[model samples]
Target chain A: MNEQMTQKPYVIGLDLGGTNSVFGIVDARGDIKATTAIKTGGHTTPESYVDACMEVLLPVIEQVGGLDKIKAMGIGAPNGNYYNGTIEFAPNLPWAHDTVVPLAQMFSERLGGIPVGLTNDANAAAMGEMVYGVARGMKDFIVITLGTGVGSGIVVNGQVVYGHDGFAGELGHVTMVRGAEGRLCGCGRTGCLETYCSATGVARTARELLQNTDRPSLLRELDTESITSLDVSIAAEKGDELAKEIYDFTGKMLGEACADFAAFSSPEAFIFFGGMTKAGELIMKPIREAYEAHVMKPFRGKAQFLVSGLDGASAAVLGASAIGWELK
Target chain B: MNEQMTQKPYVIGLDLGGTNSVFGIVDARGDIKATTAIKTGGHTTPESYVDACMEVLLPVIEQVGGLDKIKAMGIGAPNGNYYNGTIEFAPNLPWAHDTVVPLAQMFSERLGGIPVGLTNDANAAAMGEMVYGVARGMKDFIVITLGTGVGSGIVVNGQVVYGHDGFAGELGHVTMVRGAEGRLCGCGRTGCLETYCSATGVARTARELLQNTDRPSLLRELDTESITSLDVSIAAEKGDELAKEIYDFTGKMLGEACADFAAFSSPEAFIFFGGMTKAGELIMKPIREAYEAHVMKPFRGKAQFLVSGLDGASAAVLGASAIGWELK
Candidate 1:
């Protein structure tokens, strides 16, 4: 075998989301040479989902010079376990909802024994940031993904922290509130950071505020039960008092949580990812202010607050592919 | 030089505290061959304090076959910085309270230029456990020190996480309760875990419980203003209901904190150290119960709760000495 031919110049990324399995062939510089997608939840089983994925993915791989030119594949999925390369009990995925799917091995086998790596999506984002985004050259930092659920990827001494069971850095689940009166989380717990800082959490807060107050605002024009974070952002953009207050409350809690996280790892930076960051200074200002106010004296003013530098459309796929580059 | 002489068989340990500085010469098996002590806060200057420490430590070093037999030295002190080997702004140490002291370098210079390492006491305990006690062969664990102030040392992937600024693992300061009604901590924070679970916090709990409730207990006979954790332990031993309740509150908070910690590192064990662990099952049971009750689903039933296996009198010294072994 020629060493040059075997040293593949590209890798594949699979961003396995609840609704879409987005695939991209990426190079060392994070360029997407070819991309494709499949409906993730439409498949009846894990095997069928992989079959559908391969059908869409094959042409994309061919566009990038076929199998010999692809070094590996990496998947970023909900409940993905890096150690075993399995997707376990991912509630949002129809194919992997109730059982552990050996997705990495399946992909590897179907791809002529090419190596495949898997990890929770947030960790992938962290790896992406380190490889090609804002967190480049940082040895210790945390990447927070704020979407339907809040997620975190922690880096320490330049390596992702995967604790004893291949499951660590679940910062979103840390209780931000203790005792009976706290908000209930989907994780069967009360007062998780996810309950207060997630995109869903923001909508929940908006609904609560809308129902509890008599204030006239742009959000009142929308159906309160169907309100989304996008709606909140639009409302806030129109200078709605109530919507702005909601961001304030959300950002404050998130900043406080980051303060606690600082006490844990003392990262050089905290990189925020996902839709909520699109709110920009409206959200970022409050997060930075609250973090500085709540963090311990030694840690205050030391950590940078950054947004994901990767292009929003391609970041997740790029992140997954970055993990592919790390495969041994 | 002969390899035997260059690879000296002993290490020196300094357990520098607010009130006293304890020194020990230890062999490879964690045995304390000789020991000495000196007043820590008595000196008006760091120079005088080092002078007093050396006055007592030299004889002990001589008894262990002189400085030539010592490979390195490690100091576990308040505000000790592992990267710089200095004590920085330690409020309890008179000489080090307002300034950073290069104690490690001073010791090395005075003691024939042997390598010296230093870190906060809790980190030292973690090193001790990894080298000579219960945490042997474990790559991920946390050691919580429950003394006048609560402190922590977090190990992930077989290395202590020092963070970006060498002040990570300040778990005691993480908020247990949010908002106005929480207790004030010495660090000027409110609702810190140290405010609820430290040895001092135990005494404070006893005072509050005694003052708030009218129920009669053996603690009422003691001067409330002067009560100590030892008093609470004694009362609990005699089956005092109020004292037992105090342990329940402290242990529950600690357990809950450990649960949060699990979310961070998913450590295999949570080890308790310091005077409070001496209460044994009185404290351990509540911590275990609360941890099991509050830990996230993935982490539940996965961690062990343990007390320090090293002897109380020598553990701190042993822990400090273990860091010496890691010195290059």
Candidate 2:
């Protein structure tokens, strides 16, 4: 067989994060051949970001058989909206204004009208999971990213529920408690689900334990100032009772959060992704137990909680590419 | 202005409640011209229940041209699934076990194979609102029915979010509070959204107040057994502080629930229905204030909270008929 005939054609996938931009040349089968990274610079202008994205994707396209075989470019960023072809007010990515035009439009402008498409990184991960991961055969499930903050990518009836303004499926900001003394959230509120259950949430809980409660664990071995969610996970793996309790606590909150989400969406399962989800069963057991205990009876046995099978970095690129694949 | 030409084509709408069943013939624009009601017969047998529903709808439908001109029969039931054409395990209507198709088919056989579509009352209410009420011009909003128990139907990007098992949008049973105390829900859970914010929820709050706190109000003047949700609303209107507090508390919880839902579905507004929603500004003010305070900044000034214009009896038929409109 001729190597060139057997080889699959490539598309460019862009991952636009808060600080850096990651781009890759990927084939239909999700094989990443050429990759590049660039700083997003500051809130200078949308033109600068567009220039930066083109500069990064063009080189990768050139490296992998020039621009002709690069069928399309798929861009995935935080707050990306597929409907209006823009990203609306992402706090983390300090862009100059509220909405940014289709990263697809920018790609086509540079590449002489090649096809382009866009979606959020979280949503892209969901598409990636559908195309190439554990949820490959499933139509209903939630992809939860336990990153800097908790993010949800909901899939029901084989499509994402991007609501009226393309800002649907935000499950992290649900209220766990309401009165005073509920912890302050990053969004300047009290008792947000992300305030208690995400990695930053776990670290905050550990800090609170050191400051208020007298729990014995390896977590207390370090100064409260330096304790990390990783230390808590490590201690839990070593059979530290307090660490186990902490994980159980985190899992319990997440379980209840998943239950609430289950009530509204009635998904088949919830797939976990991002950093803190690495704790695995230590965090899963409590979540499952509480979820069953608290969920509506009909929804009790319907949803499963599991970790994602896609590599974090590769998943976003593949997810973005899936958008291009869908459109193409 | 002859009533003949403008007397739009009527479709038979059947509303199956927990205790009673009502049937009405509705014109194209949701005007209910004729209606009839019957007591729901004994429980624990599909034979009796199906007979009751058939008896309820058959006569009223016959009054309007013998079901020939009736485009379709739309039934608003509890736990009805639009996908499999079944109603599975409704708590209020417990005896209905996989009885949707048999009943619809039975009716269809009698009516010359006219289409019969069955869906849950909440979802039907959503259709009613979209087709006839406050949401008539909008494609995205959540319709919350604040009755004996809270119920919700969600619309996103011009479609409903029916989950993998056809049980999505059970918004009433979500665990809005983490670990709340008090009476258990019909589903054997504690702290459901309905447990705290429904008409029954308001009564629970009033009783708790009568037991726990010492404050002076017209509530004290009323007989304990005779106190009702209406008395509470009236008392609050008459400058009674305790009644005002009860409404304020319910409104607060409701607002928080809205903010949480906003994070999940990002609807443009919420349309309220059922008897309890008549509390009007007593409920609307607090919900709006809290939702504005708690929702994500981007979604902050985007969604509205409004009253349902659909009559209580007509809600069922209009909601179910909307599905036919959606499918057509």
Candidate 3:
């Protein structure tokens, strides 16, 4: 639409995770012209974190013909607030855990005042899917990221729901189980969906099953404390009965939860992201079966559940960069 | 904004409940200029029901000068679908129970081709609140109606969430308790919020509490089968401990449910409507307290809990009429 927009064919995307901050200079087609990463938790303060980020990012910017070739930058981080372009009290971010960091503004100032946008990682993934991945052309759908924690990005009437506090899509925290017997969650809640459906939750479930039942499985060979979702997947692939049951349990809860979610926004599809989706049909089959069985009558058989279409390695960075395309 | 809009200064609001179809001709200020009603279940056919409605409506149409003075019509009915302007499978509507009635189109055809709109009662009430009640200027809020059944109208980013289907805001049916011990709901589900928080649910709670405990109260004088929510409210007002405890249980479940709803939309307010809200602080205090106690840390104390400000007698009709104002 503009001369500069056509001339500047790339935008910067920063996927700021607890372990690493990945930087990608992406073209409009989702092609990563250049990419780099730096350890995130090494910085003692927000200011120092941004300083370290710039050192790595400057070279990537130069690789893509300098800052002028980039239209804007988008950051996907834990607790990133789209409305204010700040990361607020993100527990896993060392520099932002206790204080709200105006990371977008700081980056914008250093990058010659180009527009910068920010949102939580899940929402960024939703934007990515909408822009160049599976959710393209879909006006309404939900992107669910099932990693160590479960996160959601809800789209209604073609826009992501940021809500009143810019933190609306916290579906993982919605109470799946109601009382004392429900598992304790990281948020200090009991019986949250994250307590049962997240990747870590799957491992936890595997541990519980291994101890509670005597069914022989490959998982029992591993040290119980060190069990991971990957181990469970491997066992399930090998037709381990206990591991399959664990997936059944996990997928049942996820499907049941999606049924409830349908009652809320009734999206056209539900896109799954993160490590848990990698279990493929072992996980998806039960999710579909449970969703059909549990969904309200009007919504039965209406929503499609699918895994993310983006490349797993670059998906986070692409998702973060997708936010840049919409920055004004 | 137009000559005809100024000339036709009124719209028709029909609150089509199971027992009564209350119709009102309202002006821009929510003033009822003319009103009428018809028994909803008296007719054996949808056509006859519309005939009965037209017979009474003609007089009101004349009383308001003429049909030319009315700009549009809106119906707030059980199972009303906004997208199609139809009442689909309304179980309590005797003539329309198993059929989809093009009620809005029928009204439009009968009223000199005037435009008409229809939506479920809760969504109508939400529109009413936005246009003429306490929710004025609010972009995001949830209106929960606790009557014979519980219903909700969810607003996000200034629009009522119609979802993929017209039936989006069914918060009444969201599962609160998820096991065999949970109450069975009219929707054939167990442990729905409606089974615990509706006016009928309040009576059910009263029966459960009275039968299970030996606590003395004014409600003991009444037959358990015939005890109404009104009786419980009166007993609670009279300082009956058991009655208060019933409110506490009902309020606690409702508060917890609202906390979950917050995870969906993070609404700025939760507006209460219908007969149960008449309990005033008896119910409101507990709902507010529990919401604050249970909501996510980011959302705690941020959302205001309030009662609907519309006059109870005209609220439903006003709500329906509000939809008329938006009809194209």
Candidate 4:
């Protein structure tokens, strides 16, 4: 293994998203030496999906000095389980929605039995942050991905908390609103943190704000139904009051949710990831303020609030590749 | 250490309560060989407090074959920090109220430098459960102590989550109610789980139930202000409608809180400890029901809810002593 580590300086990373299966050959320093992609859809089964992936992935491996130079492979995918190295019942993946797909093993078998590791994308992001991003030196932190859905990866004592089941760190589904008043969530629940703080949640908030009040703002100029979180961010940057309020509402709830989280693990920091974090201090300031205001007195001002240090476009790939380095 | 483990067959356990400091000599099987107690409050300083504790503790040490037979000492106290082995600003301890007290180090110095460890009572309870109670052999579980105040010890991946500050697992302080309608907590926060779920919280619920409605029952037979959780339990045992309702309310809230907790670490079980658990299935039923009803679909029916296995009278001492085995 020591000899292998010296000879094989690269690892393959797969960021398996709903729309695209992106493959990157990453070095130890997180540099992408070669990359390729194929559409993640149109596969009838897990075997077919892997076949299609390999067609594009093989070229990248060859470009990175062939299979002998590759040490391992890692994958970041929705519903990926660290313990099982499988993607279980993922709603979005065409081939893995109902059955457990042994993805890491399949990849390992195809890649000449080099070890492969897999975990949910959020956990991958956390590993990326711990290795090459903002959480580099911290052992106790939470990486919260505020994307299409609010996802989380929890680290404690320098390891990801996989829980009794591999499906832990579902902070996005914690009920913020307890009763009938909560917004409906895609997970068949109501009032989840995801329903109020995800990218889609932010757009919904914009829609609700536009519908509930006649407040004059730049958001009113956009088509009400199609207003995305990005539109709200652009409007807020232009000093639009209502757009700023939308961020405040989202941030405040996020902060309050974090306050509850502090009572759970008291992480060293809360590292925000994904699209919603692009709002920057617009979202961060309110989260910090609400955390201080709502958290137990002992935890006040104890946690650092920061954004992911990994560049957005390559972060998922970097996060996935980081997992390869962890393979024994 | 192996030779010491064979020669020194006992560890000293201290359960430091606000009223009494109980000391016990415990063996590997959780048996108490000797025990004694002293009033915790008469001392004016931490030094004097330790001096007084030693007076009673030395006799127990002698009864258990002297200090040479003692491997280490463990203290379970309010606001105890595992990292520094100190009791920090514990309001219940007169000497430690406003000061950081190096109680563990002091004991170690007095006992010829045998290792000493200290942690908040909740974490100690968790350790106790893992080592000797219902959580034996379980790697992931939560031990919730529902005494006068609510407390918790969260174990993940077979380790107590002390967080970055050694002050994690404050689950009792998690907010159950989000808005102004939330109850005021002793922690200077509003709507904490402790405020609504502790033993005192149950009594408070009984009081509110009697006051809010004209329901005629055995609870109204006693003065409302003086009504204790014990009184409510006694009434409920006799099938008092209002008292049963009180347990239901408390259990429901606890269950809902556990549901939220499930989203955090996804423990295999939630072990109830301390006084309120005496309500038996009355409270446990509602908690399990609420947890299943409110938890995310994937987590439903996955976790077991159980009561502490240790005898209530000696559990705290055993919990403290269990920490001794973990020291390096």
Query: Highest TM-score, which number?
Result: 4
Instruction: State iRMS for model 4.
Output: 0.7
Off by over 4 Å in 1: A1-7, B1-6, B51-68
lDDT of 3 by residue, B71-186 (tens): 89989999999989999998888898899999999988889999999999999999999888989999889999999999999888988888877778888888787768878888
Off by over 4 Å in 4: A1-7, B1-7
Measured with C-alpha atoms, the lDDT of residue B305 in candidate 4 is 97
**lDDT score, candidate 3:** 0.91
TM-score, B chain alone, candidates in order: 0.96, 0.88, 0.96, 0.96
| lDDT by residue for model 1 (A50-132), tens | 89988988898888788999988989988999999999998888778899999999999999999999999999999999988
TM-score of structure candidate 1 = 0.95
Better of 2 and 4 by DockQ: 4
True contacts kept of each: 0.80, 0.88, 0.63, 0.83
Between prediction 1 and prediction 4, the one with superior TM-score is 4
Q: Which ten residues in a row have the lowest lDDT in candidate 3 chain A?
A: A1-10
Second chain TM-score for model 3: 0.96
Write candidate 2's Cα lDDT for A1-328 as tens digits.
Answer: 7655653377778877877788878887778889988886664667787777676677778788787677777778877887766766676766634656555676678887878877788888787777667787888889988877888888877777777888787788877877797889877888888898888889888888778878677877788887778889999999998888888888888888888898888888899888787887888789899888778777878787888888866777777776666665
Q: Per-prediction DockQ, in order?
A: 0.82, 0.66, 0.68, 0.85
- For candidate 4, lDDT tens digit of each residue in B1-328? 5755567888888999989888889999899999999999989999999999888888878887788999899999989999999999988788889999999999999999999999999999999999889999999999999999999999999999999999999989988898999999998888889988998898888888889899899988898899999999999999998888888889999999999888888899999999888889989999999889899988899999999999999999999999998887
Whole-model lDDT, model 4:
0.92
lDDT values, one for every candidate? 0.92, 0.78, 0.91, 0.92
Q: For model 1, report DockQ.
A: 0.82
**What does candidate 2's lDDT look like per residue over B136-156, in tens digits?**
778779999898889999887
